[model samples]
Target: MELIERIRLHAARSPDSTALEWPGGTIGYAGLAAEIERLAAELRGRGISTLAISLGNGPAWAMLDLAALHAGLCLVPLPPFFSEGQMRHALKLSGAQALVTDQAVVLRERLDLPEPMGSWRVAGRPLSWIDLPGDPQAVPAGVRKLTFTSGTTGEPKGVMLGWNHMEPVVRSLADAAGVTPSDRHLVLTPLSVLLENIAGIYTALWSGATAIVPGCPEVGLIGSSRLDTAAMTLALDRFRATSAIFSPQTLQGLVEAIESGLPRPAAFRFGAVGGAPVPPRLLERAAALELPVYEGYGLSECASVVCLNTPGHNRPGSTGRPLPHVRLRIAADGEVLIAGPGFTGYLGEEPPAGEWWASGDIGRLDPDGFLHLEGRRRNVFITTFGRNLAPEWVEGELTLEPAIAQAALFGEGRPWNTAVVVPAPGADATAVAAAIARSNLNLPDYAQVSRWIAAEGPFTPANGQLTGTGRVRRAAVQGHYQQQIERLYQ
Candidate 1:
């Protein structure tokens, strides 16, 4: 069944059950259904077919998203972290006919867009509608949603997905995570990202659970990459969240807070960590702190999660077995390929000419059927001595040491591997050097870090060295530290 039908069923079956929770408010299932229907009617009245939603996480955002589906309008979600250029590119590329946003004036000033066509109130917030120019971009038939991937540089590409591509994944995720009506799923990541949108909120709603939707600041997100741990703890405690989706860096911060004596939420049942490669030690630390963290693997092209580790069926180092709906196979060259109903196609791009989507991640399926990912195929670097190394493999080992906070290995065509190390606070050069030495002991000689230089500071989105999701932008880092890396080689 469709997501809209599920919402209606929840309303009919349990009218008084809370469907969504935000700061200072809660909307029950009946009330949520009413609001969705009301807004959907308003959207249809306005003849909104291709609508763009550019708002922060809240009840209105949730309402409009579902309302669009009910209204039979093609929806495009705009990530708040996107640059003005990216926003413009997305608006034009997706051919959004109208935009619904809370900060219309701000966005207009930032993007130099025209004045709003009009305004309307939904869920008690005044939202403006800006009419876009030209005909809407032609998308493949059956495309109901257009979600853009968060790229490291340049404008992100839009991935078109329909109900057929999304609903099954949501159902499979709810099953794999054991989501039930008792689960209070917290929305920590932005709902614009397909990961949080599908696996977090959509799955929770499908399971008839309460979804706690709060603004990013309320959940400890200061900007794109930085997180405020105290705020996060407070939000988790406030909502009594049973499940949440987190990026690896955010999980690390939460783990550190718990280790430093912050109260861990006893009600927290499951935490899905993904969006980047997670170090196995981090998972071990989280387990030690009594935090149930399950690492997963996914891509925007695949409509979010392809494989996930869950409580009863988890391998610490492997991204768990593929979900029931998807088929996983390892290519002869070691690329992870997914064969499933997911991934309709990319907007303005030809569909890949194959039954399987090459995930571009190099991985191996263990005898137990768990998928163990090494690194991105494009991220593998060959040393001057003919030794091939995946930098993430080495970096993952380096970060296992307590003193080494971050490591960016760069040695393509160089004699030996070296890194720019970001040391943990109060760590001295000797300590960082010792940590590198300890990490090298665990790695093969060819992949070991032979030399290193201390990073002047942390890799963050503000510095353009990290993506919004907190993955290191290796090209940016390489360019920023070219002198240091060259000096190490010399």
Candidate 2:
């Protein structure tokens, strides 16, 4: 069944219970339903048979999403930080009837964000269900939510999921993550894609938990971009958030709160981190805050998480076992192959014969069955001496130092490993190089970053330093920094 129908069921079951909460906000099941209906009514009338819904992690974003699906329009969710070129490409390919966005890139390119509302506040406005007309025509059977892979290698590939394909993944994730009706979850991802969509909101509600989308003050220095980390602490304290799935970047903020002797979320129990390989130090720091943070592993193809550590089975470096009804196996080449309730296939690509997706990730199963993500398949580089190196391994190690924000390693068909790195603002490049030199001492001689050069500036989505989901785009960085990397060899 669609998430809207499930929401209807819950609203009927618990109309008076709090269904959503954010800092300075709260909504009951009945209130949530009414708002969704109003949102559906408003958009379906505006020739929005298919909506390209653009929203950051927030209440209004969730409300619009559920409402759009309930209103019978196919929805395409955009990652929040897509550059103008990327957004335009995705919007055009999505065949969207209308666009919705708060992304500055969208506005700078004039994608008609504010729409007929004549204001950027429509996403946050409170309109009653009574304000909307009766629901419009329902969506067709193939109607779906479109999620574009972050274009890490090249152009983005849209992954479409029929209403039939998504429900089971939501239930499985909620079960695996151990969310319950008493739990209040702070949504820490943008709403424009399936990764955060199913894992964040749908799964939270499936478990009867409350999900909050922090209200952004306005687009400014102190807006959502800064994220109300301090305010999040207050909300967690007040709402008693028990469980959350977060990007590692947000986990870093929570680490600060813990170090400062601030009150930890009392009900906060289980948390998971994704979007990158988290350092053991980060996880250890999170534990210091009394937050049990597990590193999650998945891609848009896996519908968010194929594996994650839950309450009782916490393991460092491993993204727990697969959820129930999900099947995982290792291919001969070490690729993590999956057959499960998640990710049927890509939009244009033919479904694999067995309904299995070979996660481009190369990983292995420990004897205990927990999975460890090794690195990307394309990342394997053979040095001039035929030494195969996974640059991701070296890079993951280098970025752990607070002074370094980005690192790319290259030695493919070359004499030795060379690195081009971006230092954190105001960091000493010379000292960082010394640290790198020191750190590499522990690594095998062949795998070590034998030489290094400093990057001129941070890598960006525009220039391909980061994927829309915020994971460092390795290929782009390597390509952009080829000259600097070569200089190390010289």
Candidate 3:
């Protein structure tokens, strides 16, 4: 069944059941369905063929997204973490005719947008609607969602997907996570993220589960890199969240908070960690704290989730088995291959000719069928001595140290590796050096960092050194610290 149809069915079957919850309010299934219907009708009446939205995690964002999906208007979700240039590129690439955003001030200042075309209020939050001046660009047929990829270059690529691509993933996630009306899923990340949008929100709606979607600030998310785990834990406890998702960075913060004596929320039943490789040590720490986090793997091309670890079957170091809907294989060269129904191709790009999509990720299925990822195929670097290593492999080990927060390894055809290290808060230079020594003990001499320099600050999207999803932009990072890195080599 279509997600919207399932939502309507839930409304018909259980009108009074809560479907969405926020800081100051709660909406029942019937109320949510009615609101989506009303907004969808208004959008259709306005002759809107394409819609874009930039809002925080809240009922307003949720309703706008559902309404666009129900009205069959193509939806473009502009991520808040995107720079103005990337945002403009997405708007132009998708040819969004209208944009509704809560952060109108940012848009006005950044994009030089004209006066608002009108105002809209949904679920008690007021929003501004701006009519953009672009014709609808041609996209592949059945493209309903235009999601931008966090490309290494400054410009992000637009990934086009249809309902057929999204719904199966939603159902797979719902079944994998065992989502039910009793599960109060917490929105820990931005709603614009495909992971959170499809796996978190859409899956929650499909299963008739209540979603607690507070603004980013309420969930302790600040900008792209900073997280207040204490505040996040409080929110989880306050909402009694039964499920949520996190990037590895956020999960690290939560684990540290628990170790610092913050009471762990006992209501959590399912917590998924993804977007980048989860350091196995971090998972071990979380498990030691009784935190129920499952490691998963996916890409935007797969419509968010391809494989996920669940309570029923999980491996701490491996991304769980592939979901029932998708087939996974390891090529002879070790690239992960995915064959699924949902991928429509990129905007203004040719459709994939092959039955399988090369994920660009190198991985292998263990004897138990769990997927174990190494790193990006193109990111593998060879040392001057002919030793090949993936930076992520070394970086992951470095970050396992409590004193080191982020590490970017760079050593292509160089005698030794050098890293730009961002120290954890309150960690001193001596402490960081000691942590590096400890990390180096775990790595081979070829991949070990021989010298390192302190970074100016934590890599972030604003600084163009980190992707919105929290993965470091390696090329950008290396370029930004070129002189310092050269000094280390000398």
Choose the strongest candidate by TM-score.
3
Q: Give the Cα error of residue 288 in candidate 1, in Å.
A: 1.5
Clashing pairs in 3: none
Candidate 2 local accuracy as lDDT?
A: 0.70
Name the candidate, 1 or 3, with the larger lDDT value.
3
lDDT of 3 by residue, 234-330 (tens): 8888899999999998898889888999889989889999998788988999999999999999999889999999998998899999999999999
On the 0 to 100 scale, the lDDT of residue 12 in model 3 is 98
lDDT of 1 by residue, 1-490 (tens): 9887898899899998999988888998889888888888988898656888899888888889988887877889988777777788888888888888999989989988789977788777788888887355455556778998766654578898888889888999999999999999999988888899889889988989999998999999876766798889767877899999988777887888888888998799999999988988889999998899999998888888999999999999999999988999999989999999867777888887788989889999999899999998888888989987888878888877879878899989988888999998899999999999998898888898888989999887556676666667888888999998888877
lDDT of 3 at 375: 89
lDDT, candidate 2, 378-402, per-residue tens: 8888888888777767776787666
- Give me the displacement of residue 329 in model 2, in angstroms: 1.3
Count of residue pairs whose backbone atoms collide, per candidate: 0, 2, 0
Top candidate when judged by lDDT against the true structure: 3
List per-prediction Cα lDDT, in the order shown. 0.86, 0.70, 0.89
Better of 1 and 2 by TM-score: 1
In model 1, the runs with Cα more than 4 Å from the true position are 400-405, 423-435, 454-458, 461-464
> RMSDs, each prediction?
2.0, 4.4, 1.2
